[model samples]
Target: MEWIFILFLLYTLIPVWRQQRIHIARYKTIRKLESNRGSRVITLIHRQESLSFLGIPFRSFINIEDSEQILRAIRLTPDNMPIDLILHTPGGLVLASEQIAVALQKHPAKVTVFVPHYAMSGGTMICLAADEIILDENAVLGPVDPQLGRFPAASILEVIKIKELEHISDDTLIMADIARKAIQQVKTFIKQLLLPKMDEQRAEQLSEILADGRWTHDYPITGEWLKEFGLSVRFGLPKEVYLLMELYPQSPSRRPTVQYIPIPYRVENNDK
Candidate 1:
């Protein structure tokens, strides 16, 4: 009985130990990356619940508090100082993302995005406004389709299809009908905002792609895809930029580097 109990404890502890080790390793890695980087890197931390701001089990939602914090951080930088934004966001509130993007655009500093992991949905939209986007080989930036609660236009189409199948009437056209409406709604919303910055035809095309487009299976989008969408993207950080900083750590030139912060996940308590 004692041996069995000991074995169970060991088994349980092993996984916990491994998790702790991984967390420590990640912390060390981030610390190393932060060290001796000449540019001012402000990390915008975001880990919000699905709907609420402080609830557990973080989901893809942007809280106003977090948005305000980000804005405040940007304001803290001295006037005329060049800064870089190393963004790593899976995307949250569309409005919040827009607010941040606008601030970046208005800032005296140049805006650049560095994606070491994944930036999807609103993340990709934010990258669009950037002066340059730096993507690692493993990094992925994808689909900017806005979702209402949990329903994208595609999901709304699925729901309409189910309703039509159940009703079995002229209502069979409902799914197609709903899709059209959804597409128009998305297009209007995007056009009002993006049209001013982009060519009208290009903006419309992007809006359609975002509304009904499928999720990307490929993690990091190919350079061709980015260029096709009219984005200025580059593979890997420039060697000379890194080298220049290494040489002049004290008198380092200011450049925009968006800091990517990891979202925290909550563990469910079965006992609760």
Candidate 2:
């Protein structure tokens, strides 16, 4: 009985201990990056967190809490210091995103957004306000089109256009009205973020392309396309950025699909 009880305690405490160690390592890496860059480093990474008591993993996004914490970090930094935001979220609430974007836009020092993997929707919006956007060559960004509940705001408007006004339900009609406003609001905000980087004419054009219902909400916008749009985007992130990303391993709910000996290997050039 004593052995069984001891084993149960070990099982419960081991995960907690491992998690604390990961947290410590992550903070150490962030501090190292900051020391090297001489800028305030803030990370808004949202990935599959540790499994719950039920063994189910949950994901995070740019919510109010994220906004609050980031905002506080920004406030703590001096106005003259540059900000290096490492954003790896699937996007979140527009209000929170806007709050962060506006703050970044107004900062006197240069602001850079680093996307190691992907930053969708609201994440894209935040990138717009940055002086420079750094992305991994294979990473992607996403459309900033507004979503109304389960439906895209653009899709909601299309329903009204295709269906007769009388045939549309009262609920759908009400949602369509709100959707129109939401699209306009997002476009206006996007334009503001773009204006600093482009002329008024180009800002208006890019705003329409990103916020209008021209593409699906999850449409992957590559860095090449972003450059063509006249945005200051660059490919390839620093080695430290990739190192920090490894610290954020997702909690796997099932068997691992890929297996490899986790070390660097080099091919020998022995032809000589």
Candidate 3:
């Protein structure tokens, strides 16, 4: 019965293993493209397929755990070697994003962000830390407005401020005040992050544009729009960038849920 079970597991895992090898080869090709520059390529994408288990897909987030990967990449790369960071995410925790951004800022070598797709909210924050940002035609970056729970702090505060003079609920009053402070904090942090690359005046200006909640959380600020906003933005990504996205193509069948992945143990070689 044990042997039969082992065989069944191996049969199921064969396809998955083969796919992994193919994807790895694709990454190797991308790395080879930058070998002459002694560049390190790190992908911090929050793709549904990458984070999913089985068929269920969870929200792609740049969370605390992601810091470990960034740190490892930094450690592995020699000093002064350029790093190409591939990003495709909907954003996650502010602090987690800040940690990664700061790491990139402090990195001795040049850091460039390649966005093959959208990198919104916290993801936009990370891109700001990059020395240069490369964007595909379809890629969109969102505002850095802080989100309190599911609510956009900017929107919440706007409503509360309007209703403050009139009769307003206690909950609204409390949340509005909290939102006001949160907005200021986000604005200040963004300015600090952008300071290394730009002057204080420009940094503060860009921070206000990104975090002042002028645009809604999901607004798709395209590459052209971003350039107008005074960011160092460029269009056109390498062929390898698109090829990499193929490895984790979005599945229409994948719903937002906890992903479950199955792992198979290695079978001993009886002949040995």
Candidate 4:
């Protein structure tokens, strides 16, 4: 009876233990790569929604939880050492993104942001603070236009302005004023994030382009477009980056069936 109880406990804990060991091994691999490159690395990757138990909605973005994680990683890095940031996100709360952007900008070391797939909305805002932005050949950054609930802030204001012009929805006029202010606040915040990389003139120009609702909220801005727009965006793929991405491959479906094959930690240590 005692042996049976021990076996059941081991069976229950082995998977969790193996999963944690794999994570540690991955972190070690990344650290080795960064050491070889003469830099420290931090990753801000959103977990795939497919990892959820069911088809229930899950968010993978820069949020309050990531604030402490990013700061902890930064603290672990030496003050004079350069930092490589791997950013893979769909974006999230504006204040959350701003906090990260400011931290990266204030770091005593050079910060480079690598976008493997895409960084949209508030994610794009964070990249603006990077000294250098590297994107995979097919990666993209999207408009930084703020959203009011499910609608774009600028879009909300436009609707109100149109209503006023057509002399309708007098009761909703106050909402329009709030929307306009919200849009302006977002543009201002983005501009401040870009100030370290570009002058006020260029910052305002780029901020307006990203926040003016000229393009759809999710419109992809390719590396070429970003370079042409005056950003120092380079297009290239780092081998270590590809290796890291392979470790946590994106799920192809919302409900993915996953199997964990347990291996000795020594056998699983080869990340190259």
Question: For this target, which candidate reaches the highest TM-score against the unseen true structure?
Answer: 2
The residue ranges of model 3 lying beyond 4 angstroms of the native Cα positions read 1-11, 50-54, 252-272
Per-residue lDDT tens digits for candidate 1, residues 182-218, read 5566456655545555788987877666655476312
**Model 4 misplacement above 4 A:** 1-15, 49-57, 165-174, 251-272
TM-score to true structure, per model: 0.56, 0.96, 0.82, 0.81
Best by lDDT: 2
Ranking by TM-score: 2, 3, 4, 1
lDDT of each: 0.58, 0.91, 0.83, 0.81
Tens digits of per-residue lDDT for model 2 on 1-272? 99999988887788778778888988998888899899999999888867453446787988989889988998999999999999899999999999999988988899999999999999999999999999999889999999998999999999999999889999999999999999999999999899889999999999999999899988999999999988999987877788878888787757757789989999998986
Predicted structure 4: lDDT: 0.81
Instruction: State the weakest 10-residue window (summed lDDT) of model 4.
Output: 49-58
After superposition, which runs of candidate 2 have C-alpha atoms over 4 Å from their true positions? 51-54
lDDT of 3 by residue, 22-92 (tens): 67887786676577446888887776553322445556688888977897888888777899988999998
Better-scoring candidate (lDDT), 3 or 4: 3
What TM-score would candidate 2 get against the native? 0.96
Candidate 4 lDDT tens digits, 83-181: 899888889988888888888888898899999999998889889888889999999999988787777777777776565466756645666677788
